[model samples]
Every structure is written in C-alpha cells, then in structure tokens.
Target: MHPQQQLALALLAYAAQRGLAVDRLARQSGLDTAALLSPTHGPLSAKQWHDLWLNAAQLARDPTFGLHFGEAATPAALGVVGQLVQSSRTVGEALTHGAALLPLLTDQVWLDLAHSPQSVWLRFRQLPTELAASATVVDHLVDFVLAFVLHELDGLLLERLQPRTVRFPPGARQLPEHLRVLRAATLAAGPPGEYSVELAGACWSMPLLTADYELQAALLQKITQWQAARPAVEPLRDKIAGYLLANAYLGIPSLEELAANFSTSARSLQRKLQAEGTNYQEVADAVRKSLALHYLKMGAYPIKEISYLMGYNELSAFSRAFKRWTGHSPAHYQPASASRSLPG
Candidate 1:
C-alpha cells in the first residue's frame, strides 16, 4: 500500500475527533474529495494526501496541524508496545525488550542506543515512507517507550517529556496533565523523534530490572523469532533510505550516476528499484523531503538559503518543490516555535 494511504487514514481518524469532516476539509483544501478519501481505490495523479493536510493546516492556522493526530485513538502497534513495556519487571529490562520488539511492529522505524563518558544517546530512524508520519509516530513511540520503562522501574511517570517543540494546539490541557502524571522535568516540544534523560554512567551500579534472565531471554527470543518470520523486504527500503541519505544534498543524479555508485548499470538499478516498489525519482524526492524537514528544524537560515542549500537553483522552484514534499510554504514553518521547544 502507498504509505500516504496510511497517513491519510490516520488523518481521517484525527479529523473525526476534531469535529471536522474530512469531506469538508478536502473541499476547503481544494483536494479531490474522492482521491483524498480513497487514494488506494485508484491511481492518484496528484499527491492529494499531503496537499489536503497542508491546506487544512493553513486554513486552521496551525502549523502543527496534521503533524500529530490527537489522542482520539491509540494506534494498535504502539499500544501493543506500551502493553509489553508495562509487563516488564524493570525500566532497563523494558527498554531492552522494547528495542528488540520494534522491528516486529514497523520496519519503518528503528531505535538505537549509544553511550559515551558523558551521555547515553537514543537515536531513531524513520523510513522514507514513514517520514510524514514522524510527528505522530515519534511522539507516541518515545512517550510510550519511556512510560513502559519508567512505569516498570520507578512506579512513576517520566520526569519530563521534552520534544524539540510543543506542537500541540492552543489550550492543549492534555499535555500538562500527562506531563504531571509522568513527572516530566521539562515538557518542551522542540523537535519530534528525540529526547534526553539524566542518568548516571555506571551501568554496573544499576540492578537488573528482572532476576529472570531465562524468562527475559525467552521473551526476547520470541520477539526476534516473530521478526524473522516476516519477509526481509523492508531492508530493501532501508537501502533506498541509506542511498538517499548518502546523496541527499549532493545534487540530484541521473539513473546512470546512481547505478554507477552502486557498481551496476542503470538498467539494473531500475530493475532493483522496481522490485522494491519504487522508482529513482520517487526515492530522490523522498530524500529531498526528509532533508527539507531536517533543514526546517535547523531554523537558523532563511527559507531561501535552505532551498539553495538543498540543491535547488531558484527560490520559486524550491518553494514549489517543498510544497510538493510537505504541503507548507517555507516561510510559514515557524522556526521560532521549534527553537523555543528544543533542549539546551
């Protein structure tokens, strides 16, 4: 299925809760009502999902609109992870297990951990198709991951839920109370998909969350087994993402260039992409889209500067292409809002 279809379905659910009908929103946004509603039913010449959401956000005057679907419903996969975390005996154990289980839920998302003398860093990667859903997916995934771990370990909520920016709507009381319950130290919403916590570096000083290494091992084995049972198809998608990341700002290359980089001919490259259910242009655009978001978060440069930095030749073309990727104009992305929400 087209990843946009999944996003549209999530948006449709969110709209229902806001008392805003999708059909009306579609009309207001100049979206093809049928296409927006049922993109998978037929081939959509235009990317209606992103366009409509952008329009709705513009009309609603909320930059964060369509970025996050409200607490109207908990997505099933996230809920499953939440439940699994709650069952774990300790915070550390829960985190280890949850990290293990991520692949089973969505290959589109991954979590990794690294520690140095100073800090333990948790990083996340979203698949190209998962990029648009980053706000919702990352927010929920981080919160739920912590909730399960902290809940198991401390029997309390997280001390803080800090994001790069608080993208919630005005009078968003849901956030403050949620933070209080979690004991969040600072709940700023700077960027999505990342967070930090204060921790002592001594892993040996910490006790294991559970004494049952055997049981924990068994559960982890089951999760890995489940993941292995699925076809290893998403790795192909990750390869596409990896290629884009390597080439995102190098300027758009022809199929020949891409093929040469892969040590293959253009035909072989085309066949490989086709087998993975994508094309060269689509992958390039996806890379551009992800970079656009990254640049938006950077917030120091003007939109035009960002455009040039992203490899576009002219301001107008960059604006049009950005709109094509994200549905919002560069000027309206509100870097200040993002800045206020980031951690030091």
Candidate 2:
C-alpha cells in the first residue's frame, strides 16, 4: 500500500508549526515533498511511513511526536474513514467505524477492542515486531493514535472529550509529564503488549454533533463502494493471526487448512509467510503465547485448563511452550504481578 498524501501534508504542516521546513523533512526522509503534497498520490509503503515518522520526530526533537502530530489532525485529514466517523450517530459508532477501517491505515497494528465490567477499552493489538524494537518509538505511537482520536472528537459531541483512562502496554515506562502534557485524566499500564485507550461506557451513546441519518446513510454506501474498490493491503501475518484467533476454539488449523481458507496453496502460503519474516508455526506459537499469558494472569483458570484451551493435549506441552516463549514456567511468569487487571 502507498502512503496517504493527506498524511504527508499534515506532517508538513505540523513540522512547519515547529519551524521545520518541508524540504528539510523530505531530505531526511528521502521523500519528495512535492509528491507528498499531491492530491492524487497513493498511500506510502510501510518503510516510507516509518522514515517519515522518524524524520518528523527527530526534527521536532519531541519524544512524543506522534501524539503531537495527532493533536494537529482534523477529521478530513483521515480521508474516507474519517468522513464516515464524522457522520456517525454516536461516539461508539465512530469508534466502530474506526476499528473497521484500521486495515486501511497501517499494517503495523490492528485495533483490538476489550470490554471490562468497569469500562470498554480499545487497544492496538498484534503490533509488528519492528514497531516494538524501540520502547520510545512505541510510546510515541500510543500517544499519537490516542491524541488523534481525541483531537477529532474534540467539541464534536461533548463539551470536552476524555477517556476513562489511558493504558500503556505492560512493560512501557511512562514519563512523569505524560499525563499532564497529554491531558490524560487517568493513566496506567495494562497487560497487553501494546497501547490501548479506554472509553467510559457512559459516553458511548452520546450523539455526535455532526450526525445526519440521511447523509450518514449515503456516506455508508460510499464507504462500502470505496472499500470494495480499494485493494486490501493487510499483512499476511496479521490475517493469519486473526484467522487463528477466530477459529482457535475449534483447534489451530493446519497450514493446508489455512491456505485453503486464504484460497491459496500451502506452498504459496509458506512462501508468503517466509517473505514476511515469519512461518506458520512461529505465528501459531505466538498466538498461543499471547493467549496463555492472558489466561494465566486472569488467575481464574487452572494451568491444565489453560493448556487445553491453547491447543495443547497435555499441560506439560503447554508449559514447555510457555517456557520457550518467555523463558519461565507458567507459574513463574507472574503476569498479574505487573498490574491489577489485564485487558481481556
């Protein structure tokens, strides 16, 4: 997929506000400032997007560049999905539309929604390993996404938009000023290995300031047509992972079955996964590891029960796999030690 030109313009605008010129940013990113500003430009590739972010962050000299840039974005800046979100009837509907269109944004991560008895959480799940290679970069990305959501929702429905809480991934270390600068009311870490934003259930049904049933219906039609016309560029790794999660209870499907589901041959599936720097077994193991950690931390399931749920015939097999994945026995991996509750 190509980089959305709207984003390039937004990046330029944000940098300009900070006294960084388009040419300088372009030079650092090896991007054509002219092309990025063109209305007809296609979406940027993953690497191109990464370079643009790094350059902007470096030039801004802000550890939270993504958050800052997100604050500057408007509804139209998000393109089609943004428009749909703007016309939605409620904040919850806008969130639904946002989650559905995430596959179009970046392959690096997809939205994962989790609901607790207290609140509903929207998390970015299954991030690309590369995104996690640097903790600082990941931190910026979390704030960046959350800031964008808040900025777009600003004064559109409520007098002020705020989440019940802002949650970072388990291992992330938040800066002391994160809450003050980000204006987060409640900030904490959760068990997910990636970032999440919590929405108060009470705010979910609030009517959108821009709601128009007739216009929104027409927009929905347009979204359907445009999405079908647009090519899907979601990463295979993510697709496979999603498929596994969807069908996990039935059993971890075989490579052949997965290939069949994707309408391809096993060999081709293997080749594609290989190109993405992963394999079927590796992906399966990763899914099991994530789910296992989730269950163990819940403290409601027995070790043997967790093993069976994860597709292991015996508890020993699951334990071995767990140790291999995290270098600790199931009991030794006190995931709950890090937090009061893990995002389910």
Candidate 3:
C-alpha cells in the first residue's frame, strides 16, 4: 500500500488501541470514515491527512501518534532495507545506511541533510507527486521511515516520541496534551511551514531504539551492494529540479523554453520525461511545490511575497495552487506559535 494509506491505517489502529472512537476522531478531523476506508479511490488531500493526524495526536495526547503507523506492517519494497536496519552496528551507522537505501524504496522522495559541527539536521524530503493525494503519502513516508529506523535501532517500541515540530499546525487546545506526550521543549517561534527536528549529533547515542549488531551489519552491507548496481532515478529528477530551482516562483516556462534549457526538442523532451514516468507539467509543479516549502520554512517572506515569487499573479492564484500542492492555504500553512529561525 502507499505510505498515506499505511499512515491512515496506522492512525486508525492507534486510536482504536487508545480507546478513542475512530468515527468521532474522523468527524473531528473533517473526514468521512467511509471515504477514508475506500481503497479504490486515491489518497486523501494533504490537509485532510494532516487534520486526521493532528486530531489523532490530540486525542491520544501523543506527538508520535503519527509515527507509530508504520510499525504494524513492513512494506514490500522496504523489506530488504528493513532487514539491514533490523540487523547495524550503531544507531548512526544504521541511519546512514538507511538514508542511502531510501532511494530504493521510492525515488520520488529525497532526504534533506544539514550537517554542522555541533548538530545534524536530518530532514525528510517530500517530492511533489502528480497524484492529488501524494502529499499524504509523503507525510506518511516521513513518519514511517523515521519510526521504522528508530524502532529497530532501539529494539523497543517508542510511545513517547514526537516530532520537534509537526509539519502541519497543532489544533486548538491540543498543545498541552501533545506536550504531555512529546515532553520536549518546543521552540517559541520559528519558520512558517517546514516541520523539523533539531538534534545534536551526540544524541545519536541516546538509544532511541535498539537492535542486534551482526545481523544489522550484514543487512547494511547487502543493501549497500544492492544499491551499487541499482539504477538511481533521483539524479535525473534532481537534474530537472536543478533547472527549476533557478527560476522558482517566477512563472512556468513555455514548452520551448523548458526543452531548450534541457537541450532537446519538445517532442523528445516529452518522450524522455514520459519514459522517466513524469512530464513537463509534473516537473514544473514539483519544482514549485518544493520551492514553496523551502521558502515558507525561511519565514522571512510574507505569504503574498512567496505567492508572487512562486509565479502567481495574485495571492489567490497562489493559494489555489498551494492548496492543490499542500492541501493547506498559504496563510493557514505556517504554524503560528512555533519559533522560527532565520535563513542563514
């Protein structure tokens, strides 16, 4: 199943275990229980998914409520990597291996890494998917990847963990309950949209999760060897992303402009993109979606400024596009209470 469905199931299971009514939670999150249960249709919208996760967290009083969704089952693609992780020498090595193995599971996502002398920022990248429900899939993947690795590392279940910041905003009257679960001091005011966890490199040794050493090492090595021969699609996607990064939010380029930049005719470009399982519009949308999050995280630019930069002639146009991208309005996307850091 896609990560989003897996995530929704995970949240449903957690709520059931906690003795909370799933229907009630669904209602609170503005979800239709029947629709959520429909497997034939695509995933829920980004906002709908976030609202459900947020509602579940509030009801369970656990920030990690969303994280636990992956533990219930191992995805087919993640099996080998899961073994490698289930078996690594240390938490750091395991995570490093897992990060490298991420592409094997899905090239649609990328992990963002910010390494410093004192701290290491391990951020999950949510690549733009053409599917409307792709945002939820991205969200669930972030939770799943982190929770799965942490669980194997600690060799124990972590009921108390929470993201330092939730990707979506916290619901009203929910912070106290969430605080009870996370038990971590939150930053006062920070970036508007990006969700992050700031941890010291030393914290890697803190034993968030535990596992067997030899088996994990063998698994890691196997994954390493397997990845060596495997085709890496991210490089190609990044090439496309690199092209868009230069003109982020300016406006969508014409088919000719895009094809020229890539050094090919429009027909050839279309064919190549189709072969790559994406197209011009998909790539352009992905670029803008990514830029939206990156700029939003900076918190310096106003919503209108970001909208314009994103190539929206008016804020409303940007808002509509953003909603389609993130399932939340630009104004409503940024968390109000969290402390934001300035871009360096």
Residue 181 shift from truth in candidate 3, angstroms: 4.0
Query: How many times do residue backbones clash in model 1?
Result: 16
Q: Largest lDDT belongs to which candidate?
A: 2
User: For each candidate, what is the lDDT?
Assistant: 0.47, 0.65, 0.52
Per-residue lDDT of 198 in model 2: 75
lDDT of 2 by residue, 1-344 (tens): 13256656666755754546668888777788777766667887666666778777777676667765665455555678677888788877888888888666665667877654567778875566444424555565556667777756653553446676777777777764456435668888877776777777766777886522332333334334433543345578866765555334334656865664444578999999999999999999987886666656655556775576577787777777888899988886545554432222
Q: Rank all candidate structures by their lDDT, best first, as comma-separated numbers.
A: 2, 3, 1
Give the alpha carbon lDDT tens digit for every residue of 1-344 in model 1.
33334434445544533435667776664556556456464322233543555555544444334222322122221345545654565445556666776664444457666555554444555545633543443444344444433333432121222322222222222354345324555554323434544333443124443322232233344334434554534444455455445323224445664553343568887887888888887887776676666556656445664565456778888888878777877766646655432221
Report the C-alpha lDDT of model 3 over 1-344, residue by residue, as the tens digit. 34455446546744654446789898887777677666664455656665676677667654444444433223222445655654455445556667777765555456665645565556665556553324444455555565454434323222223334433322212234223322335633334323345555654444433422332333334334434654434444455554455332224456665554343568897787888888878888886776666556545456775565566668878788888988877656454642442211
C-alpha lDDT (0 to 100) for residue 55 of candidate 2: 78
**TM-score of each model, paired residue for residue:** 0.30, 0.56, 0.36
| Candidate 3: worst-modelled 10 consecutive residues by lDDT | 169-178
The global Cα lDDT (0 to 1) of model 3 is: 0.52
List runs of model 2 lying over 4 Å from the truth.
1-3, 115-118, 129-134, 211-344
Give candidate 1's TM-score. 0.30
Candidate 2 lDDT score relative to the true structure: 0.65
Model 2 residue pairs with clashes:
2-43, 2-44, 3-43, 3-44
